[model samples]
Structure formats: structure tokens, C-alpha cells
Target: MPHLVILYTANLNFPTEEGGDMSGLCRALADTMIAQRDETDKPVFPVGGVRVLAYPAAHFAVADGSGDFGFIYLQLRMGRGRSEWVQQRVGAALVASAKECLAVLLTRQAVGVTLQIDVGAEVFDGKLGNLHPLFK
Candidate 1:
């Protein structure tokens, strides 16, 4: 189970150029996650459990109190049981995809992007949903 959450400043609205929308960025990253594979060419994450979400912070302060500065923070949380190599590979893919998706926005504005991965440490986790059935 791998979930990617993105948080960005509200001022960093989607650029006017193509592929500059928030939904498109989320979808592209999710697609990138779906395409990841291990050293043996096995799927990195279960498609049924893969999720991507993005939210804009309406209230926030950027560096130097400049409202023109924008930043995007991406965090991928997943259950433990994968090799470091696999994790690195997945991280690279996700970051590359994100950069590509935000290319237009980056050029037009001052943007900072950060990607982080959080491995399992869950004391308790539970889920109840029909989405898994659709994937199965």
C-alpha cells in the first residue's frame, strides 16, 4: 500500500500552459507509480492500494515572506517490506514524473519541490472499501 499526498501553496495555481493542472499532475504521478517495477521486473506497488492526492494550502507563508514563492511537498507513505533499491527506483520515477508535469509551472514561477518516502511504522491500520474488488 502506497499513498502519495501532495501539498502546495494556494498561490501556486495551475499555469495556463498545457498539462499545468493539478489533476493532471496527480494523475501523471499515479500513472508513474503504477509503472514502477522491482529489480526482478515485478510490480513495485499493488495497483489496488496505490493512491495519489493533492491539496492546496489556502493560508501559508513562503520564504522571506514573499507571496510569489511557491512550494510543493510530496510524501509517499507505504507499508514496509521492500528493498532499498526498489525504494530508490520508485522515488526517482515519482520525482522525475513530478518534475515533468510541473515543468511549465516551474518556468513561470518560483517553485520548490520536495519528495519524501515514509516506510511502515503503523501501530494499527484498517481499511474497508470496494475499490480493491474492482482492481482484483
Candidate 2:
């Protein structure tokens, strides 16, 4: 149940002509999530459980109240069970991928990218989907 939510400022240049679009970012991140493995060499995150969603914040303000600044915040929410080492590994991989995807914009503009992992302790988490079958 690793769901990645990407929130980026509208000022940033997304969907670049070279195919650095939102869908491309999602594919990169989902691939990163699926590539993670535990110490036992087993998959860290389920392939069918990986979900990546991106949204642009049209109304926002970056550091120093300068509209020229842009930012991207990535939050990965997953069910609580994995060890700290696994979490850290996954986070590092994801952050690297995100940065790589945004490298051009980062160098050209005032942009900040941050990623965090949030282990959920949900009281009642429900789900209904047929995606697992497709993965099989």
C-alpha cells in the first residue's frame, strides 16, 4: 500500500517537451517503488499496490514570498509494518528518481524538492480494486 502523492507549484515547468510529464514522473516513481528489495532479497513493496498521483498547486507561495520560486513536495504513505532500514532505502530511491526527473527545471529555476515517508496507523483503511489480477 505505498501511495505516492506529489504536490508541485504551478510555476514550475511540468510536462516538458522532452517527455518529463506528470505521467513520466509517475512511471519513474512506481518503477522505483517496485525495484526496492528487503535484506532477504524479497520485494519490499507490492507491485500491484503501488500508486503515484501528482497535482499542481495553482495558488501557492514559495520561500521569501517570491512567485519566481517553485517547489515540489512528495509524500509517500504506506501501511506500518516495515523496518526503518527498508523505509529509508525506499525513500532514498524515490527522492533520487524525483530529482533526476526534475533536474533540468531545478538548474534553470528557483525550485526546491522535498520527499518524506509517512507510515500510516490507520484506524479503518478500506480498499476495493481489481488491479491485483492484472499484475498477476
* Model 1 Cα lDDT, one tens digit per residue, 97-128: 99899988988888889999999888988888
Per-candidate total of colliding backbone pairs: 0, 0
Off by over 4 Å in 1: none
Candidate 2 least-lDDT 10 residues: 13-22
Off by over 4 Å in 2: 15-19
lDDT by residue (49-128, candidate 2, tens digit) is: 99999999989978888458988899999999899999999989998898888777776688888898999789998989
Clashing pairs in 1: none
Clashing pairs in 2: none
> How high is the CA lDDT of each candidate model?
0.89, 0.87
